[model samples]
Target: MTAHSPSLTPAFWDASIARAEKDSGVKVKQVVAPSTGRDGYAKQLQASGQFPDLLQSITPSQFTDGGLLKPYDQSWIDQNFLLPQGNAIKGKVYVPPTNSQIIPLVFYNKSLFVKVGAKVPTTWQQFLDVNAKLKSAGITPLELGGNDPFAAAMPLTGALSVDVLGKNPQWIQQRHAGKVKFTDADVVTAATKMRTLVEKGYFEQGALNVSYADSIKNFNAGKAAMYPMGSWYLGSIPKDQWNNIGVFPWPSDDGSVVVPFSVGGSMAIASKAKDPAGATKFAQKWSLDPKNLKALIESDGAFPMLKNKTLADYHVKVSPAFTESYTYVTKTNTKVSSMGWATNDEALPGTGNDDFYAAAQALFNSGDVKGQMAKLDKSWDTATK
Candidate 1:
């Protein structure tokens, strides 16, 4: 109800708030966020006083490489934290994302599949086959929100066909890295398949323009059978529609297998925090401490990553398929890349989101495949430089 940044409100802060006040030598104070979005949030911070005990959810480049973060106090971490390595970074912790929600799978209605006498898809070809049947039956096979390019890019996630055809997630990353040519068969073919989905009306009408918020609403409203999203969704969508919710990995060509998903995207403490110890304490509490976890879930319906029993029991309604989906992702042999969308270099280049989106928009909108990619190569070349 308050105007604070939704990000800043994570219950974990309750711990740090307590610690900061007890020490009382320092106060972690901040104005709630702007009415506007991200850019305004950053500008608001830049315009203010000396750094507070913490700056929640800031980019690593600003707080880390820039010497803005004070390396985490390993002592507190050793006592209170549990995480995979490298999370500590060079030193200071900042903000770490803890609870998560489930991402959705684009599933076919089994009733519909049976009526049409079509098998639910297992491989890439099978998925397409199901789509064809759905079209003939006059129930749209998939719902897409093209109104927002961010949402539009989401469906391609299920096409593990690219990974299947290309052979693995590693191959995709290598190619994205310039280590493997973008022209390689795996990347190219994957691009082609995604483009095909667009051509086939696999997504909802006017999808190119759909806002990310509306895209999910449309899916749960039964506008689409499957949506590729995070497990965190379990906490947010309505209970009535909960029964219809089912999950599968972004399916591999054979819907049976999955590319293991790495649990990435947790938060870190800011090196810049005036109260590094307090921030560290908060991050840990925010992660799994009982009081904070309950606050987050009951208030926001966020998913817990800790496997803490208190949180576990609270999530029973949504855990089965949701937890398993995460297991399938982590089950793979591959190590998730250290970063992707999380990286500053990828996101914060000179022209910022504007310049990057211009390229992405061009690629997604271009009707001709070859022309689109050639343009993509040119855009990446410029953007990366």
Candidate 2:
């Protein structure tokens, strides 16, 4: 009955738990994990050997590979989960997405577009044209949270990956399989595209030092024309300026690419659940029930993955920007995870993630497209090996 911090709890969790317990007549106790780091939580789980019946915020890979979770039934994933990458890892449905995530979108100030006399761009060339117009009008064309390494890489990789790796959606798996290299010409093109943006002064001043919150503040204050982030950002916009908000898919060379879909939202059931049957029922309701899923999506500004479910199904008032991003998700069939998803040690180094973020920081700051990529390739090879 233990869980992640209440602050980080998903919107639908408490209600779902209450409903599940009422239906099943099982009294559940909620234990809060210590207010410590992720690894500390894992260590605590191990030392206590009391893995919560319903695990939250942990990926399937982390739990399954660690021998802490039971592999989920394939039928459960098939009938209940609308996973972006399908519902299996290594041919087993160990973990499926808790909710779909629409990432790497460019949210813009519609008024700024009007002032600069630019339409929402659909092609890479048009995107550059719009950037020029924004700059000419004395507006920062892009507001990036560069001080936060992952934030800096989100839009860069999102746009660049589509242009460079769009032809191969499974490029990450391929790279891991030793069938491709990060030093490919297209990969360099993608990395260099970001350098080109810096060279053109399209980004806001001191972007290299700005935090995500700072970038959001700058964008909302009308200091920038475009802010590229995930759909989750919709709720953070100030109500007074909400009407001026709009969204566009990141433009690509031929307009054939779409935003890469990622599924970071997941919950797993521990193998050592005290009441296995009850835990299974709760997990199913939390992930599969259309009503609960809808709440999660609407409340968190995530893309819905329920069968035949669309944004129209949720009748709540939502920002136009959210609707536009969902439309993009529905229209585009091509999707992918960021590169680090494939690289094992791909998170921030000390936090049990990896070194990719730091390497990406080098790429952005050094503008040494080739040199940085070589370093990245070496790191990836070592990690995958």
The TM-score values for the models, in the order shown, are 0.73, 0.89
- Report, for every candidate in turn, its global Cα lDDT versus the true structure: 0.49, 0.67
Put down candidate 2 lDDT per residue, 150-198, tens digits, no spaces: 7777655675457755677767666667787767888888777777888
Write model 1 residue lDDT over 1-385, tens digit each, in one string: 0134353353545554565455444444544444345334553554574344444444545445545555444554444433322233433344343444322244333455565687656677877777787777777677656556544554443342236322653543443477754455555566567677767877667766777788678766766665655444545566665455655545455445643222222335445566666666555544444444454454444444453244355544443444444454334433222112223222323333343234334445665555554554565567566
**TM-score of predicted structure 2:** 0.89
Model 1 misplaced stretches (Cα beyond 4 Å): 1-27, 35-49, 73-94, 97-120, 157-177, 254-256, 259-268, 290-303, 307-326, 329-340, 343-365
TM-score of 1: 0.73
